[model samples]
Target: MSAVIESHGHDDHHHGPAKGLTRWLYTTNHKDIGSLYLWFSFAMFLIGGVMALVIRAELFQPGMQIVEPEFYNQMLTLHGLIMVFGAVMPAFVGLANWLIPMMVGAPDMALPRMNNLSFWILPFAFFILLSSLFMEGGAPNFGWTFYAPLSTTYAPPSVTFFIFSVHIMGASSIMGSINVIVTIMNMRAPGMTLMKMPLFVWSWLITAYLLIAVMPVLAGAVTMMLMDIHFGTSFFNAAGGGDPVLFQHIFWFFGHPEVYIMILPAFGIASHIIETFSRKQLFGYSSMVWAMASIAILSFVVWAHHMFTVGLPLAAELFFMWATMLIAVPTGVKVFNWVTTMFKGSITYETPMLFAIAFVVLFTIGGFSGLMLAITPADFQYHDTYFVVAHFHYVLVPGSVFSIMAAVYYWIPKWTGNMYDERLGKLHFWLSFTGVNITFFPQHFIGLAGMPRRYPDYALQFADWNAISSVGAFLFGASQILFLFIVLKTVMGGKKATPQVWEGSRGLEWTVDSPAPYHTFTTPPKVSL
Candidate 1:
């Protein structure tokens, strides 16, 4: 493929970014908004990481050492909320803003001002959420799921704030999804057909649609919660003709797709990184796209799997169990494609590739664990156990978070025109890899040993594995500081990079200069097959 740039002189009139805070405060530039999102996500990751460390510290032994059980629950709740809404999701949105326009050969996001609004509102939402910790009765403690009666009747005064913050976040996500959909649907350069677009672009397009479909469901769920809390309704109150299980129904309806929403982009990122480092065109491109679509479609039907232990009917349990297991077919196809792409290729173990490979392996481990939990009989045992916790943390930490790291390493050169410290980059990867495995892998054993999740204290038999997990957690948390330092060091100064920073890189984004211009594809570039 070749791209012919059709430049216009006027497009170069204001080719540099503004010099002050206003550039970020009021600018509609996609790159600026992308940077804002990335920086904000990093900040949230750190805050959430601290909360995680605190949880781990208290659980470092059999007894609560640093925090009371109430505070521990709050930490657990806030950590999940911040990491999901504030860290992983925002980070992907940031990547979408940065890469999608460039990959699709568009000038910028379709709704630039809306993109700005989408990102700016995020910090305020989190501020409201974090402020709840200082409120009377403390922060939300009903777990991140915030199940019915707990979120409504027994919840602290801060639950109202949490609901309000969720509204803000939902609004932001909806707007961001709209921007992504419009940009991709309307802005691809000439001849850059749907299949011709990069896999990353395809992933975001699917994700945006999923967001539009489910974000409203989430909004409705939370709205119902608000009404129940304030207006004396019983939407989820069994005491007032509402079934508490109804909350699980509504929440999981949003929650399960929300899981795919987080992982789908990781799939895309892995595809690109794996292909690039393998020095080969991705194997099974069409199959990969269809597989992702299949997975997305299957996500809606699998929600009940999470509720199997809620005393669902036998038929309902079997239906959900089978539906959940069906997801593995497409997911397995993705894993196969990645591995096949790497087979017989001149693969290099770059920092990005290392992370991507880890994503494939570790995410598959998470996937198999998911299959275990999909067995209705097995789910009965695993539900709410540390095993469940182990499964998701594997999926999320190594699965989503590691993919994000891969993307940053793969594209930071294009964004900054400087090569990062390769030595430190690899060091970060190894430490993170070692730390994450040491942290979560042990939980599988302990969880099977009957340790429950969300508890500040555990029985003596669970102590050894919990201690190992906590130590690994601290190691994993500390390694991120090294990641931050490496990124900052690269941004400050490093070896200059060429347009095609990686020898095997392929995409419209790579066709631009290293440190892509303030405005790119100002006049649509014609793509050739």
Candidate 2:
């Protein structure tokens, strides 16, 4: 295999990316598509960040000063949708497109045309979703989850558009997942066995399976919503022999796994970053793989925990409580692996390491809060409150978002052949770190004091913390502008990078050129490990 790979003729048919607009539109090249996904996700991140600033500005005072209550609801709804569907999920997929083939020694994604189709559909999906705000009834105000009667009976005329957009997004996700699974399963270079594969590949493979299983469930849930709205079906309409709780069950059935779908890749990324900076082979490599697989499987059975506030029978409540809490075991195993990997190793706190460490600590805080929410009785106290918002944002912003940022910092040098300004990167990190805690830590107290989420106004008692939170929100949002600048600065020009960008980095990816070639592994490379 090694001889064949070495003897194979280099396919010079590949030149660099096509010039101009046609490069993005018609190209099936993984690198080009990956760049497209990353840029698109970043644009959505900025748009979503603006919506968040609006929400925080409204909450800056005790009254609805900045916008009308209706507009406020639209901001919150669009923020959630855009961040989840448009930013976080797509960013991970973008990472997968760029890294997976390199890590596995595949030349390209298994279905190249399908990959292009999957990515191209996203802009259209988001276009439909955003276009809804301009529609007569305004955007989806019922929240990203789009729970029952509110989403069905009381939803806007744009709900139909929202439903269609969701279908398009789901289709995109499913196709992307299929492409990932096929590439990983069948395209590994010779000698690159399953256990020897990097943690990022493992994480994404699990995530791909999870996506394949649940994206359809989400599509079905929305289709049922469409039917309830137009066809007069009672899928969620209690008056017509359907139960609203049924919608919660269906939505959450997809929603629980959906949360893991976003974070599991983060887990993968943290493993690589932690191991790299720690200057050690990853601790518990097999265990990390099993842990991710465990978390993905556990995600399925824990759906009902989100619906605990709604009327669930005693047995079902207890079942979900135990199931949700059980997920903590594998999750703890992962956190332990990261820490143990770093213990007594020559660790360096570079920008990626800082974010990875933050992901570990902050994500654990969110996990503990999640455990609190898992307790059926306690959730009754915390459900629908700002505390819930705090918990998820902690998990998402610091956990997933931080990890994504870490990946960009860690790999951008390889992608661009230019090192980002390390001082500026750390500065961006500190601002983000400070801003995130200041913004969310206070929400826990306000939530405990009986302030609910999704409200445009708050009581006088909630005024002060809300003001502080808004300040932090502004800081966090502004820091991302620095991030965008850093990325562009790195891409355009900076200190030149070596093939092995990080001193201790280990992977097939690092073996390639600094800015990996237009074509790689024309002949399947023989993997040593």
Whole-model lDDT per candidate: 0.93, 0.94
On the 0 to 100 scale, the lDDT of residue 127 in model 1 is 98
lDDT of 1: 0.93
C-alpha TM-score for every candidate: 0.98, 0.98
Model 2 TM-score (2 dp): 0.98
User: Tens digit of lDDT per residue, candidate 2, span 1-529?
Assistant: 5534422432436567789998899777788888899999999999999999999999999976989999999999999999999999999999999999999999888888788999999999999999998999799999888988999999988999999999999999999999999999999999999999999999999999999999999999999999999998999898899999999999999999999999999999999999999999989999999999999999999999998878889999999999999999999999999999999999999999999999999999999999999999999999999999999999999999999999999999988999999999999999999999999999999998999999999999999999999999999999999999999999999999999999899999999998988778768888887
Model 2 residue 510 CA deviation in Å: 0.3
Error of 2 at 196 (Å): 0.8
Residue 471 displacement (Å), model 1? 0.7
lDDT of 1 at 117: 92
Candidate 1, residues 232-251, lDDT tens digits: the string is 88899887899999999989
Candidate 2 backbone collisions, by pair: none
